[model samples]
Target: NAGVTQTPKFRVLKTGQSMTLLCAQDMNHEYMYWYRQDPGMGLRLIHYSVGEGTTAKGEVPDGYNVSRLKKQNFLLGLESAAPSQTSVYFCASSYSWPPGDREGTEAFFGQGTRLTVV
Candidate 1:
């Protein structure tokens, strides 16, 4: 329990609804990311933050927003839910980027949040 943790393991959301996914890490990592997993596509980054109070858009940021208000927490928000947004969300944290030559610096992932939009 000293790694990444995501809230609400499963949820069913109606179209046009809104929700926020919470990701918290206790490892004091400098980089945190939010990713979604689809059937055909693998994990796609939604948003990421390099440090506290700083965030950047990732591959699929159209229907998502992110905030890193604290060093240990990263939040992903959906303004309006859609069927296309339904996917398994994963939160991760890493001690370094690229992880080059770093044996123990690989990103740590949560169990994932399964969301269904109908």
Candidate 2:
């Protein structure tokens, strides 16, 4: 399985520009998520899908959107970029997390998508 692969390992965007970062996994996992990491902050969830055709907003869903049309792919779209969005984006998946405990689940992460907004 490819696990997860994110396109455009690095990118630069001017203020107000837009971009879409692609994430694909071959594990056939049912859950997928998009998160952003900033200095001194832990990964903050932007959006997630429990399964294909289902999407949900997360803790930090503002300024971002997500789509899960295919079972193996999750796309994160930034319509208007801002300097505050200049952070490392990470896409993660899990085959199955340990039941009954959220912390017990191990999430597999992609290399990362770095976006710089001037």
Candidate 3:
């Protein structure tokens, strides 16, 4: 099964242009997330969905929007792309955590979507 796949592995965009990055998973997981990783800094959450039909903002939700229409897919949209948004984007999924000890959930990552803005 395709655990997780991201489209347009690499992209180039000009300022003010818009694009949408697609993410798909076949694990039937209940949690999905979109994050961006820049040099030096660790992964910063952009958006996440706990389950199908629900989406929420994360630490770095500015300039981005996400949707979880189906259980296996999550989409990240960038409107009016800017150079500051250039970074490696990753989509991840995980199984629901257990009640008390919920700190061990490991995120399964997609290869990554690299975008460059000029």
Candidate 4:
């Protein structure tokens, strides 16, 4: 019954280091998303996937990439981590809603992964 889980609760990186954040869910959801939150700010979408083998960019996709090779897992990668990318990242998944009818849909969120770039 693990809703969602993110690996590496915390990490520190140099200005140009590279890393990947792993997210896994057992909910069998059709939609998955990656988001980042700065101190005292709301979450900002980084990338997302609609289903297995499908991915898309979200509000703040710069410096980040994501993959959904399997239906139950999503991975977010920082090719060259930057100081500005330092933040707490979150992973979420939701059941599919009908096209053009996304009302009242909710997602389950992971605890979070904190990353710092210096």
Clash pairs, model 2 backbone: none
Question: Which regions of candidate 1 deviate over 4 angstroms?
Answer: none
Alpha-carbon lDDT, every model: 0.94, 0.90, 0.91, 0.91
Cα deviation of 45, candidate 2, in Å: 0.8
lDDT of 1 by residue, 1-118 (tens): 5699999899999999999999999988899999999989999999999999999999999989999999999999999999999899999999889743498888999999999999
RMSD of each: 1.0, 2.6, 2.5, 2.7
Model 4 error, position 102 (Å): 10
Instruction: Provide the lowest-lDDT 10-residue window in model 3.
Output: 97-106
Candidate 2 local lDDT, 1-118, one digit each (tens): 6789999899999999999999999878788999999989999999998989999999999999899999999999999999999999999987665422465356789999999999
What overall lDDT, based on C-alpha atoms, would model 4 receive against the true structure?
A: 0.91
Residue 98 accuracy (lDDT) in model 4: 46
Please say which candidate is ahead in TM-score: 1 or 4.
1
- Misplaced by over 4 Å in model 2 are 97-105
Could you tell which candidate, 3 or 4, scores higher by TM-score? 3
**Residue pair clashes in candidate 3:** none
List the pairs of residues colliding in candidate 1. Answer: none
Q: Which scores better on lDDT, 2 or 3?
A: 3
lDDT of 3 by residue, 40-117 (tens): 999999999999999999999999988999999999999999999999999999877532246635567999999999
